[model samples]
Target: MAVNLDKPQRWKEDVARSVDMYNQWFLNFAPGAFRATRISATVSVEASLLATSYLRDIRPETMKKNPSILSMLRMATCPPIAVDRLIGLAGVNSSLVKAMEKDNRLPVRVTGDLLDKELQKIGEIIERMADPDIFVWLARGDEPRQEEIHRAATIVADRLCGAQANPIIRNEQEKRQLAKIKTWLEARGYNEAETKARVDFQNMEPGTFSFRLNVKVRDNTVNIPVDAVIMPITANKGDLPVLIEAKSAGDFTNTNKRRKEEATKMAQLKQSYGDNVNFVLFLCGYFDSGYLGYEAAEGIDWIWEHRIDDMAELGL
Candidate 1:
């Protein structure tokens, strides 16, 4: 059955409701809650061994004075020196002093006035392997353990440096939006089973279906995964599946690129599915003029999470 597209007023209301729900949830979001979960997993023994070996001889007094180098050492995820490479540079089984380069781990360059340049180089190398942020923990005068260094390194690498650091928050938002969409679909006579959290069509004929929609971003085409979909248990010869893409964002800035990306994805899906599929963009927050432009340009049918009453217009 063909879907309805004439309920503009209802669509607006749905959008407003969805935005309100998102705003309410965002207000209570605690970033620290996510940060607290960072150390749930333990670091590998190999990594700990490497970290311990690197920091063995560094004096606590020197580490405190130049904490930046200590911080780098604590955060280093991988061994800076490959065993083979180290052996080549300092001779096989050489002392730690010969292994660290003179300028390797020191925050400031060591002058010729300093005696025993090799030992200073070793100290600097140890400092380079540790993360600076852990210096506060070290300031307590507790001897650094290999596992502690490894854990701090993991936090720095995965939480501080990684994109999507707090995925739990994003995931919760997606789940909320998906639940809202599923509720709307069920109220409009779509079977609860038909509206699912994740939908995959892997074994379908090669050219006839795609699990992901691709969009051109800069010089590359990026694939956006469809969060959910509604498929009839038994399809009439001309009946098409309804594709749902749900997005939740705090504000326009965070969603601009995503909004455009989704629009591009919708355009591609429409081209591929033609009359055989329907598309709905379920947005769970506020959008600005730029978002509206992309939505209009793509000719996408969208509904706000709050104003979900428009689902009735689908006439399923």
Candidate 2:
């Protein structure tokens, strides 16, 4: 009952359509999403700059009193640097900077005494390395220009948010796909599971679905997260739930590169739950013949976003 997977010859046509659909969606919505996020980020960066007095007072006491500003410290510099790069430049403890960047706060173990020393080193590096042209207001001996502050914040916002814009789009796309699945399943009398943890498939009422369920695999020690779990309407006691992974890719190269991850998950499921385990993919975006062929060879199948109704073939 497989669609494009069973009919290998039709792969080229399906792939073309899938890619076109993804491109059209991106062209229509991606720019607006990016701009909205950047606008929000700009507001945040401007607030951080104003709090720091335009990077003129990055003293340990100031940073300690306002720990949240540490996240934006590098961005406020003349030329922003990433956390790892700042660590390399400042020659500070890698763990400290890594923790700061990851959690957006100073680690609790870093005492006030240590903070002074660390901030001194980091501040000196920024002062020495930051571009003189960008920080000219510091030497001008007058109030920082409002336009300059806005321009600097905008640049920082672009750096901070632009890198994550594609990922934001991908998350939004996944949410949309899941919403569609919810609507269709609900229409068919499928109830949504309320539990946040993994559910016992046998106990789940027939015709129920859950999002982001975790399944124990690989000898029941490792947990594999699936996008959706569905109990077929005709399910009986002890029947395993169907597992669906929602996948999207902007290009063929990344899909081919990450194709093995799905195969690994499939192998783990089969090993733990036996060959009867129902694991599948809900795919959108650019997956080419090469990617599809590999998945098919591994006995993995997919339901395209364009053909969501084919989920019926899986007893959804």
Candidate 3:
């Protein structure tokens, strides 16, 4: 019932087509998306540099008042270091710095005293590692030149861009994919789920679809956040809703690296519920034949974004 999956020759053609489509989309939209993200990132980085006194005052007290500055501190360095590198240089707990960079605060386990001590160590590390030329305006006792500030912020913003998972593009792709799915499902009389809580999969009403639904395992201890779930008009209370993962990739490398995640999720689903639980991938972007082969071997099936009508194969 799956399209192009049973025939290797046909699947290869589909992969080429999908890759071409993704490339075209990227060529058209990715630059604008990156520019928008970079502009916002540059503004934030500029503000951070200003707040840090142009990297002259990374004192413990300053850091204590604003742990979020730690990220800026790392970026302000000559060759901007990663979070882990900063932690290593400071000889502090990795979680402390990682928490600060990620959540802009220390973890709950870090007490006030511990936070002060950690901040002192981190501040000393940044002070030692701060780029002298970048902070040269401090020695002159004058405001940094506009161009100098802009250059510093741009470098930091560029580094931040590389370090991220490219969230902006991914979010846009998800929005578009979800919107398409919504239109397709609605045409078939599927209604959106009213509540945002964990979906009662077993008792899902007929012809219902939900976005970002939480489905718990048999023990109810862990919940899996599904991208979309749908119940067909023919389904009864005992039937499980159809689970779909909306996936996109910018490159082949990441898809291959992350291919195991889908297999793991599928294993968890079948282990918790039953083999009959339907799980599918709604894929776009740079998934290649190797990635497809891996997913297929794991008993997982996918519907290409180029061929979304293939969702009917799952009886949606």
Q: Which of the numbered candidates is closest to the native, going by highest TM-score?
A: 3
lDDT per prediction? 0.50, 0.80, 0.82
Candidate 2 lDDT over residue span 165-197, tens digit each: 768888878887899899989998999987665
Off by over 4 Å in 2: 1-4, 59-71, 105-112, 131-136, 195-202
lDDT of 2 at 167: 85
Error of 2 at 115 (Å): 4.8
- lDDT against true structure, model 1: 0.50
Best by lDDT: 3
- Per-residue lDDT value at 277 in model 1: 46
Please give the TM-score that candidate 2 achieves against the real structure: 0.87
The 10-residue segment of model 1 with minimum total lDDT is: 202-211
Query: Residue 40 in candidate 2 has what lDDT?
Result: 87
For candidate 1, report its TM-score. 0.54
